[model samples]
Target: MTRPRLSAVSVLTFSALIILTGCFGPPAPAPTSTSAAPTTTAAPTTSPAARPTGVTSAPAAPLSTAAAPPSSAPASPPPTEEPVPGGLPEQVAPLIIYYVAVEDNGVSGPLIGCGDSLVATTTAPVRFTDQVRPSIEALLANKSRGVGLSGLVNVLYQSNLSYAGGELTGSTITINLTGQFMLGGVCDIPRAKAQLEYTAMAAAGATSAQVFVNGRPIDEVLSLT
Candidate 1:
């Protein structure tokens, strides 16, 4: 018998068949992969009080708004002093008296007797006539007869008069005179008793005459004599 002809094709065919059979065999039971059952971790437990609530906290109370204390008011200004009259002292009162007679030719006689007195709250009556009379006589002597008479009468009516000597006080003045007068060149009894009251108030050191006639207010008749 001739040895079976070993052809290259037949040899190759048998080898291939073996290789395929091995490859098709069920894949070796997949390696039993039991990844140690993932280690089970226990969740942390919380008490009911620890649970987070959705509510937010309220704001604190507002600060008090009490007003600041008020500032004190400024003090008032001091009162102003009044200006004193001219030709007079700062604090003095005057009293004056005049005596005159009408001449035959309608002229006025010289100032015969003149006097001044003063009364202060804490002191006795002060008579300044000796010092005051001469000055008053000089004033009368210088004036014309008509003016002198008028001026004398004016002086009598107006009580308060301040001159070189001092001041006089009291709201009223009394005059008693006994003299001869001539209306139209005839001698006549010019005796008169007159009482003068000051209606207008006089300042402490006023020099001018500021009095009224008998029972008459100063405003009614301001005639100088």
Candidate 2:
């Protein structure tokens, strides 16, 4: 039998057809998807309460009291006067007057012509000069005769005479003549006695003489006993 002769080209084409048939023989399987929903998880719950701090409360207020009132200043006192003895004007007057007389005249010798009968003597003559002695003698004579004159003379003499201690209030005068006696021997007893007599006489010459206590005058405060 006469078969068709195959050319080189036909042989190549046949080999190619065999390779394509084998390559396209089978296909791979397709993938599949399911229609399902996604799931969500819930968070933990916390309490809504507030916490306390270190210092919880505040301090309480203090109590109150009433205040005191202010005070006023005090008043000043009045000036004071010197003190004089009271009562028994008669006794004090005579004593004070007599002492004043003795001191003013500088009496040294014994008292004479004073109490009763008015006669006195001394160891020596009066010491004061003639002019001064007579005046002093006059004072003594006047005192022996009257109380008013005696008081006045005492005041006057005391003013002129030097003394240690003395004070005068109203008509009343207190005199300390004891120290005067110490001055004796400087003048003779006669002269001293004469001076004493004269001073007493002068005190007796006053008309307005009075004894007082507490700034008030008293009657008969002085009298010869």
Candidate 3:
């Protein structure tokens, strides 16, 4: 029955308080960091309306509206004159052209004498400041139809006649003529009224010329038989 033991300095002070609680035991919880804190994974943020999956971009150019085309008006200079060395310029001249003389050697009958069967020829020159429209366009261009083989005979040659123009006023030169003024016989109505009134009065040196055919009155279209 003798139970009172424990005292080797209280069992060495309870064995140094159990060796200071196993050498400060609460600090053992710090080593439980299972290696996870270094995982910062936040660098993947790119969100500015995010567009870069397989990369496709390229569709912008489209602004034109249309409306620009109006600049065109600069052209006026043309009138200087002064330079004439070779030919054609001293105010040109020459352009007579008349015909109908066949007085026998090649007689085809009937024109007894419309001012003794006309004559004269000349042509090719023009511009004495415009000689009465080029001498009635060289008597309607019958350029002396071979001067009727030298005897003369432009009874308004081929007579499909045209020249519908002339005026000359002061000395009176009307001419005008259009077409269909025929008369191949019956002395071609006074040799076509004396070859268009002596070729419009020697081409408007006019002492009077009144032709008109088509407006009637080259003596009523040559009905003077």
Candidate 4:
């Protein structure tokens, strides 16, 4: 009796499902969460004993331990003086020099002035000055050589002549002599006087001479001789 109830509706529904599967297969499989290719970051480089502390070095000081010295100025020089015009007076002492004179020509009637020829070695280089004493010393020593020099060949001789000192004025020199120095004989006195005068004036660069014996001027002795 139920076999007679079968219908087309149920059969059609089953056929529609079959047709959807044939047209489009089952949905694609769900996508899985896969890891990306590993990243390749470079590691940061660092100096030994230095890192994220970020500490830095300090600047060095210009000078070490030592300090500089203080400055000072130099000293000043001394002042000087200018010299006088024509220079100073000349005076040289204790020198060796010739005692100069002229030889006399007369034997009698008293000799007058000195002549030209010299008794060259009658006196040696002796300590000289522009003074009378030194001159007298030299003259006497030469006279002491006897006969051929200050003394006469036969008629006279000059002995024991002595000079004290002298003073120079203008072109003349006044010489002081000892009294006994002029106590010589007549003819010899004049010649001796000539020698004394010439030597002294020559040394002093003077042209005339005046004599004083024992503080007495020899004008009379000169007149007598």
Candidate 5:
């Protein structure tokens, strides 16, 4: 017996069904069984402790072993001497006093010429730097007990005159006096001037002298008196 031939449509339908079954086979091998990418967990993060406000840390300093130098202080000044009370004693030496000389037997005598009447005599020790003043004082004291040595006849002896002071400038010496000046006689004026001037000159070792009595010059007082 002879077999029958299949139609083209029936053959195509059977081929299509066989291809669909091969595409959908075994549920696609169960989707390959992936393990969900292994869930990654980060370690616990810890922060440092907070610091106090306005506080900062500083670096440590290095130490040294060298010694420091010594310093110099200022020196003090010396002490000065203090002045003493009542002053010191004056240096003294013998000084001369001038007087009018007269010719006499014992004590009292007649008037000698005024030009040649001066008699140099010794008195007690007086200050060296202040000889003129003390010499005048000695002359006025009229203590000369020597024979023919008389100053009592002078107007200064009777007038109660006192020595103010004296000054020696260059070769000239000046003698000052303050008191009531009276003239016992007209001749006494020259006698007084001579006595004072000569006495001051000898004491001061001066060549000349100017005598002022009561602020009036010797020459002026003599002219007026």
Candidate 6:
């Protein structure tokens, strides 16, 4: 007995059913367990600290060891002295002056001659250099007293010699005479010169003396040592 042959349609239908079964086999299984998602942590960041406003820093120390300059010092002043005009200092001590004087004899009747120029004299104490003027003034003051020149009158003119002024320069003295200091008439020029010179030199303690008459040098011809 021969078996019956399957139809082509039936065969094709079985093959198609097998392929469809394989393709649609079973659903994929879900992930067994999800690990916690990896945590996303931003790396730690560094930031500068903030300072408050108006903060001040300490001052720095000086680098040098030298001291600060010293403050300037105050200044000082000058000195003074007492005034002494035409004279030595003051009269802390007394000084002496020599004045010519006259001596008399009953016979010669007042000893009038230059040979006795101040041969008879008086002495006095002085206080100032300027006092020299007045001292000489006193010596020649009273011609009638005849002290200044009477001793020399017989030899000299004795013109009532007048004293105008006098001044001293160091060791020198200058005496001025006015009013006919030429002596009325030149009799014994040398003796007249002696009378004045001796008196001034003695009173002033001068090394030398200059005489002026009528504002002019007494004639050099009349110069006395």
Candidate 2 residues lying further than 4 Å off, grouped into runs, are 1-65, 71-161, 167-225
Better of 2 and 3 by TM-score: 3
TM-score of 3: 0.28
- Leading candidate by lDDT: 5
Separately for all candidates shown, the number of backbone clashes (residues 3 or more apart, or on different chains) is 6, 26, 0, 0, 0, 5
State the displacement of the C-alpha of residue 160, model 4, in Å, after optimal TM-score superposition.
Answer: 4.1
Candidate 1 structure lDDT: 0.33
lDDT string, candidate 2, 1-225, tens digits:
999999999999999989988999756655546635454433322532332333233344766665655547664668778888663233112211232333333353234333212222221233332222233333333323223433312222321223222233444333222212222232223333334433333333432323222232222211110
Candidates ranked by lDDT, best first? 5, 3, 6, 4, 2, 1
Model 4 / residue 136 / CA error / Å: 2.1
Q: Kindly give the stretch of ten consecutive residues in candidate 5 with the minimal lDDT sum.
A: 102-111
Instruction: Give the per-residue lDDT of model 1 (tens digit) for 88-172.
Output: 2333334333333332132342222222211111112334423233333232233233233233332232222322222344542
The residue ranges of model 1 lying beyond 4 angstroms of the native Cα positions read: 1-65, 70-96, 102-105, 109-190, 193-225
Off by over 4 Å in 3: 1-93, 99-102, 105-120, 128-132, 137-189, 192-194, 197-214, 217-225
Identify the runs in model 4 with alpha carbons over 4 angstroms from their true place. Answer: 1-122, 128-132, 142-161, 182-184, 221-225
Report each candidate's C-alpha RMSD, comma-separated, in the order given: 21.2, 27.9, 15.2, 20.9, 22.4, 22.5
On TM-score, who's better, 1 or 6? 6
The residue pairs found clashing in candidate 3 are none
Ranking by TM-score: 5, 6, 4, 3, 1, 2
TM-score of 4: 0.42
- Clash count, candidate 1: 6
Question: Which residue window of length 10 is worst by lDDT in model 3?
Answer: 39-48
Scanning candidate 1 in windows of ten residues, the lowest lDDT window is 186-195
Model 3: per-residue lDDT, tens digit, 1-225?
Answer: 999997788998989988998988755555555766543333333563465564444555998889877658775679779876663344776777666765542244324454344666776656665465666666666634457457667766666777777777898888777776555676656666666766677766778788887787777666642
- For candidate 5, list the clashing residue pairs, or say none: none
